[model samples]
Target: MPLPDLVRRWQPGWGRCRTLPAATEVPGGLRVVLGLPGRHAEIFALDDQAVPALAERVAEAAEPTWLTVPTTRPGEVHIALENADLEPFPDAERLMTIELDDHPAHPVPNAYWAKTSEFRGVHRIDLTGHDGTVAASGLAAIVGTDAVMHDIRTDPAHRRRGLASAVMSALAVTATQLGATTALLVATTEGEHLYTRLGWEPVATMLTATAPMSALVRT
Candidate 1:
């Protein structure tokens, strides 16, 4: 299987499992997301299962707009949206390393991220220039079943100096050593270019819509 397909198959099963408002099902080798109340629904297929009732329920709840299915492959895996405007999904076009069971004994080396509480359980690699001040950093998490690469950043003064590449390479090497087969991230346009140059490939485009907390709360 391609790396993207492997990663997609692993997601939802191995990564975060939450009882989201939306429910999921598999019918006829398709993965489907049902009962999403907004202008949209999500669908994908990973295996074979019958779920006509679930599809009927979703169709009943859908708005008048045509269903939008964003997929990496037609009829393979897709996200369906109802009453939602079609927009480009935010994605990065390069490949990063995915580490499955890597636990680094050494501590993370970046100080800026160290101050934040969310930095825990994340391993990092720092890139230094000839002067030795940290120029860039790559951070990644390798849990038992899931791996994630987050926050690849370079200092403002160090832009265009290749520090990002250096740190990302360091992170990838470490992730490979740790046994991760796939790395995942949401990338910006510029970052996507860099990642592709470094051997990352785009797998799927993602689209998202947000509702404010105030809207969710009854006025």
Candidate 2:
């Protein structure tokens, strides 16, 4: 299926833009908007649309704090910042979703977490080895019926011993118990097959962009 059509299959609360047509705006805004479900914002050509008029509007908005255009033409005054925290887009990543009850119970392995913590809506589990050093970790947040996992990482030396799986399993167990029925995660190229093996199905191709770093300084 076409990328846009596949994107449409995302449930309204999940991937609303999965099936977005090439030219449709996401509801309201000056042809741009934020929080249209999933991560990132949706906007038109950054250079042509936001140079003077829309740039002023971006400065005025209280949240999201940047302008995002999925594509750019030549000579656009946008910066694709190369930094650790830069958003992912254009190249493509996997947006995977899975049903909670579709798999076996995801109980945390007894030796998995040397420490665990939760504050407000976020949950964290630290996977430690015998020496009590943190080997891997995972995080998840539950909002309504959705539990999305982020930043699940493991140290190189600890990679294939199922530590990553253990962290996710623990997170899944906790998230499900907290009334979450839907799970969402974005996987990198290296991790995509691993997630698929764990039963997550890729449903869309995502492109993420954000306001240039200069925008923040100018504010």
Candidate 3:
């Protein structure tokens, strides 16, 4: 399937853009967005209809600091960025997804904090097993006016179980309770079909492109 138009419209700002202290300029029909990566710089070009050609030019001019493409332009080529890598578009099947408007008031299941953990906020459910073994977990974040669902993971051994769906539903309910009108997240191909089946639309295909210092320094 093609990339969702809504996902194509989503653009990152300076704080959210990841690459910073950069500049953007439009030369002709192409817009050149540049970001400084230490001693070198990376560039990206955004042109709705000319995405393919523009991407090529950007790739040639300077390495991309970070980039994303819609599934609509699957034929377009892209490179990865340093300090980050791109996430492939999920298949249009197998992802169970949903959005909620209120925050779940109940205590989140599987609530535990570790020093190096990336998990945050209150998870609605925790799928742990006997002997205190954690099987899976979910996370949510407040990004401006939107409620962002960060990471939702389940153990491979627990596949085919409803644990992931349960966690998602709980988080949606919690988000709604917290006054979030809509929730957003990116799912893997393995999870897309499930999400669509659960009424979560395919908003867009997010392409993660990165540029390393080696690429930039040479450019």
Models ranked on TM-score: 2, 3, 1
TM-score each candidate: 0.49, 0.58, 0.54
Q: How well does candidate 2 match the true structure in TM-score terms?
A: 0.58
Please write out the lDDT profile of model 2 over residues 134-197, one tens digit for every residue.
8898777775677777778899978877777778777888888999887777677677877887
**Model 2 per-residue lDDT at 151:** 73
Clashes of each: 20, 5, 32
Most TM-score-accurate candidate: 2
Model 1: residues with Cα > 4 Å off, grouped in runs:
1-70, 73-82, 85-120, 128-133, 144-147, 211-219
Clashes of 1: 20
* lDDT scores in order: 0.45, 0.55, 0.44
Candidate 3, superposed: residue stretches over 4 Å from native? 1-47, 50-66, 71-125, 208-219
Model 3, residue 136: distance off in Å is 1.2
What is the lDDT for 41 in model 1? 40
Q: Clashes in model 2: which pairs?
A: 7-18, 7-19, 8-18, 8-19, 89-208
lDDT per residue (tens digit) for residues 1-219 in model 1: 554354454344222322223234434223334333443444432321212333343345434111222235423322322122232223313323333233223333443222212244567676665566767776766554345666788889878756676666566556666666666664566788777666665654432222221111110
